[model samples]
Target: MARQRFGLEGPSHTGHDVGHWDGLKAGELRIQRCGACAEWIWVAQPLCPSCHAFDPGWEAVEPDGVVYAWTRTWRAFHPSAEVPYTTVLVELPQAGNKRVLGLYTGADDPVIGSRVRGEFESAPDENSWPLIRWSAV
Candidate 1:
């Protein structure tokens, strides 16, 4: 069972929490990277799709990026998800134009290619996990 130690209870590994805190703790926007081909890949992969290399690793990345794509969800995808949240696809120029998907805060509509920075929001008082919110920079 997931512990409620943090007010915002989240998955530790199976879902969203996969590499979540591990990334934050390292001060990195840790996305799956292919060591052999040196390509940043998303949606989680054990192998590199480009070079077919099994030598995958996590690397630190800058929080800065441009909005490659985005959407405003009026309906809740998760019960814990706050409605009217803006989800963004951030294009990391430093990482081969690979996009990092995250929730955008402080706005309803976000433009494609808009500058944005990652914000690590505290995961409520009792929660020990690292939660992040993004916004226009």
Candidate 2:
């Protein structure tokens, strides 16, 4: 998640998170998996917390997931964000139930354990990156 993608400026780049970022740029949702134990890792990690292995590999995952949790807030969390937004923690079954966070844009109210699908929207220009928006399945 580059800060520039959200109209901010700072060191949003991460050596470990690059794979996830690159996947977003390619319009795919990527998750890191521990090569040794095959356990899914989120937020990126140089070493697998599961097996104490080095350099988990990244792979594209089925983007659909179930809503594990959610929150609605009036405050804009990021630059150029509209007031009053919902953020969801989605758990991908195929990705070992590893949850990923994204903005919820579904018309219906967010409910716990509701099924949702990830939608990728390309950035307006090269200066920005794509975002993974969530909606009810």
Candidate 3:
């Protein structure tokens, strides 16, 4: 195996949540759920904080979700990502308030309480990871 190249220059999943992108590629929303309490977890943790259970598993989720929160980022953290990107906190119905953070596809069409869906974009290079971009509906 070789060291993976991350960041804007590499694949979209290169920065963080590489596993999440991998799941998306397989047509799943890939959320971490606690096997003990059956509660959903975000930001991907080794164990469920709610039940403190070491048993955690990934489950498929609906790509469609409500926009819990959003913001327009003027700063370009990644060179590949255009500036003024929309970042959103999506609340999945299946997760019961569990939120996933991702970049909005159409930054100009942002709505606070609108419905949105996820679309995973392929990386420019294999070294880069796929990105889950969102669009408001």
Candidate 4:
């Protein structure tokens, strides 16, 4: 099936999390890592949760993971979003078991521990933000 574009808005792409959107535009999955403790921080924080270090740097990680958990939503939260969409929490082993949330685009039901890969979709318009979609591997 073709890649689906979910009409959900993301967090502000400013400050610490700018690299994440930039990475998606460049076809990479960039995440922050604490320079001191090397701990992966998701949702992009200014300080490392583990070591509390300032100015954590960003690194490109492989967009491959397993479905740690998931849920199917029947409600359309946004105008661009459709009913019966699935969101999956993917566990990235390459990034120290850090889980990244993304939209699931597959026909079968979401099964826990299923291998999935990331697919970055550019925004339909300049005003909208890009997103990562996951597919079963």
Highest TM-score: give the candidate number: 4
Name the top lDDT candidate: 4
Q: What are the Cα lDDT values of the candidates?
A: 0.69, 0.80, 0.70, 0.83
**57-100, model 1: which lDDT tens digit per residue?**
77777788998898877775666555666678899888778777
- Model 3 stretches astray by more than 4 angstroms: 1-19, 77-81, 107-109
- What does candidate 1 score on TM? 0.74
Ranking by TM-score: 4, 2, 3, 1
TM-score of 2: 0.85
Better of 3 and 4 by lDDT: 4
User: TM-score for all predictions?
Assistant: 0.74, 0.85, 0.76, 0.86
Q: Which residue pairs show collisions in model 4?
A: none
lDDT of 2 by residue, 45-88 (tens): 88999899999998899789999999876776776777567779
Cα shift from native, residue 66, model 3 (Å):
0.9
List of clashing residue pairs for candidate 1: 6-126, 6-127
Global lDDT of model 4: 0.83
1-137 per-residue lDDT for model 3 (tens digits):
11222364321343334446667667677887877798887777767888888747777887889898988766756655555666788888878778877777763757777899988666666565666778877
Model 2 segments more than 4 A misplaced: 1-5, 8-13, 77-79
Which candidate, 1 or 3, would have the higher TM-score against the true structure? 3
